[model samples]
Target: MEKQILDFSLVPLGLCLLLAYHIWLLHRIIKHPTSTILGINGVNRQVWVRTMMEDVSKNGILAVQTLRNNIMASTVLASTAIMLSSVLSIIMANSKARPSEIVLGAESELGFWIKFLSILVCFLMAFLFNIQCIRYYSHASMLINVPVKKMSSSHLRAEYVKRTVNRGSCFWSLGLRAFYFSLPLFFWLFGPIPMFLCCVVLVFMLYFLDVTFDYGGVVDEEEEW
Candidate 1:
C-alpha cells in the first residue's frame, strides 16, 4: 500500500513540473523570438503587416481588408471556445454522468471531477482571451484605416497599429496555448501514466514545432494561409 501511494504521488508531481516547464519555455520563446520558429514567424508577421501599412494607398483598402481577415479568424476561435465551455459545464454539472470506460478506468469520483473542472477552466480562459483578442483586432482595424499624412504623426500612428496588432496576436496565442494544455488533461482521464507520457510527447512535439533552423542565411518568412 505504501509503495502504491508513493507511485501515485509521482503523477501529480510530474504534472506540476510539466506545466512549469511549459510556461518557462513559452516565456523564453516570447522574450527571444529569433530563437524559435513560431516566435520568429510572429516577428516576421508584424514586419510584413507594417510593410503593408506603409504601402497602403490613401484609401487604405488593403489594411482594412487585412484587418477584416484577422477579425474573422479571432471571431471563429472565440466562438468555438465559448461553445466548448458550455458543453463542459453541462457535463460537469450532471452528477448522473459516469466516466466512459474507454477514457477512464478506475478514477475516483473526486479526482475525476477535479480533472473535469480543470478542463472546463481551460476552455473558459480560452474564450475570454480570444474575446479580448477580437477586441484588440477590432480596435486596430479602425486605427489602421485612419487617414494620416506622411509625417512623424503618421509614423506614430503606424507604430500604434503595429503595437495593437502584436497585443492581439499575443492574446490569440495564449488562447491557443490553453487549448494545447487541455490535451494532456483529456488524456489524464485514461490514467496518470497515459497523462505523463502524453505530456512528455507534447513537450517534445512543441519544442520541434516551435524551434527554428536557419540554413545558408535564408529566412523563411512566408505566412501560410
Candidate 2:
C-alpha cells in the first residue's frame, strides 16, 4: 500500500513538474527570444543561413557539409532511440504477467506495464522527432546549395531555407528533450522516490543550461533577429 501510494502520487507529481518547466520554457522562448539558449541559437542560425545564401557559389559546399553533419547526428540519435524502444518493447512482452515486490513502485502488474510504457513512449517520441529533424535538414541541404540567382528567380526564398534549418534544429532539440524526460522515467523503475528526486535535479540542471546569462558578452555584435 505504501509503495502504491508513492507510485500514484510521486509519479504524477514528477511528470507535472517536467511538463510545467517545458511550458515555462516555451513561454520564455516566445516572449524573450534572447533570454533562452534556444532563442539565442535560433537567432544565430538565421544569420548563418543568410550568410550562406548570400554567396551560394562560395559557401555552398560549406553549407552542405554543415547540414550533412547535422543529418548524421540526427540519424544516429534516431537509430538509437528506435533500437532502445524495440528492446524495451520486447522485454515488456516477454516478461511474466506476475506482479513482483522487487520493483520499488506499485506491486501490481498494471503499474509495471504503465512504467514500461511511459519509458517506451519517450523513446518512440525521440525517434520520431529525430526523423523529422533529418527530413528538414535534408531539405535545407538541397535548398542551401541552390545558386542565389536561381533561388531568387524561383518561388524558393532565403527565408524559407532559414526556416527549414531552424525547424530541423527545433526537432533536434525536442528529441533531446524526450531523452531528458526518459531519465526520470527510467528512475521510476527503481522507485517513485528516485524518480521524483531525479525530476527535481533534472529541472534545475535544465534551467541553468537552457537560460542564458552571458548573452550580452558573447553575442554583443550580432543584431537582434
Candidate 3:
C-alpha cells in the first residue's frame, strides 16, 4: 500500500510540473513573441493589420472584410464555450454523476470530481476570454475602416484600431489555450498515467501550433513602420 501511494503521488507531482512548464512557456512567448511560433504569428498579424490600415486605398475593402470575419469567428467560439460551460456545470452539480465511474470504470469519486472541476474551470475561462475577444473585435471593426484624414485624430484612431485588434487576438489565443488545457484534464478522468502522457503530447502540439515560419521578419517590419 505504501508503494501504491508513492506511485500515485508521482502522478500529481508530474502534473504540477507539466502545468508549471506550460505557464512558463506562455510567459516567455508573451515577453518575447518573436521567439515562439505563436508569438511570431501574432506579430505578423499585427503587422498585416497596420500595413492594411496605412494603405487604405488599396486594402480598405480587404481590411473591413477581415475584421468582419474575425468578429464572426469570435462569436462562434464564445457560443461554444458558453454551451460547454453550461453542460459541465450541470454535470458537476450532480453528485451521483461521477465521470470516472462512467468513463474509466473506476469508483474514485474524489478524483472524478476533481477532474470535472478542472475541466469546468477551463471552459469557464475560455467563455469569459472569448466574450472579451468579441468586445475588442466589435470595437475594432468600427475603427478599422474609418476615413483617413490629415488630422491627428485620424492617426490616433488608426492606432487604437490596431491596439484593439491585437488585444482581441490575444484573448482569442487565450481561449484556445484554455481549450487545449482541457484536453489533458479530460484524459485525467481515466487515469493519471494517461493524463501525464496527454500533457506531454499537448506541449508538443502547442509548440508546433504556436511557432511561426516567418520568424522575426514581421516584427522587424512593424518596428520600421
- Model 1 TM-score on a 0 to 1 scale: 0.81
Error of 2 at 120 (Å): 0.5
- Any residue pairs clashing in model 2, and if so which? none
Worst 10 residues of 1 by lDDT: 216-225
Off by over 4 Å in 2: 95-106, 152-156, 216-225
Q: Highest TM-score among the candidates is held by which one?
A: 2
TM-score of each: 0.81, 0.91, 0.81
lDDT of 3 by residue, 1-225 (tens): 553463387567756766787787777676656767666656667677778888788888888788788878878888898899898888777778546646573446666667678888898899898889988888877677666774568767766776788889889988988988788788766666777788787777766766654554235544321
Write one digit per residue (lDDT tens) for candidate 2, span 137-160.
999999888766654453358778
Instruction: Report the Cα lDDT for candidate 1.
Output: 0.72
| TM-score of candidate 3 relative to the true fold | 0.81
When sorted by TM-score, best at the front, the candidate numbers are 2, 1, 3
Cα RMSD for predicted model 2: 2.8
Distance from true position, residue 95, model 1, in Å? 3.1
Give residue 38's error in model 3 in angstroms. 2.4
In terms of lDDT, the best-performing candidate is 2
Report lDDT per candidate. 0.72, 0.87, 0.74
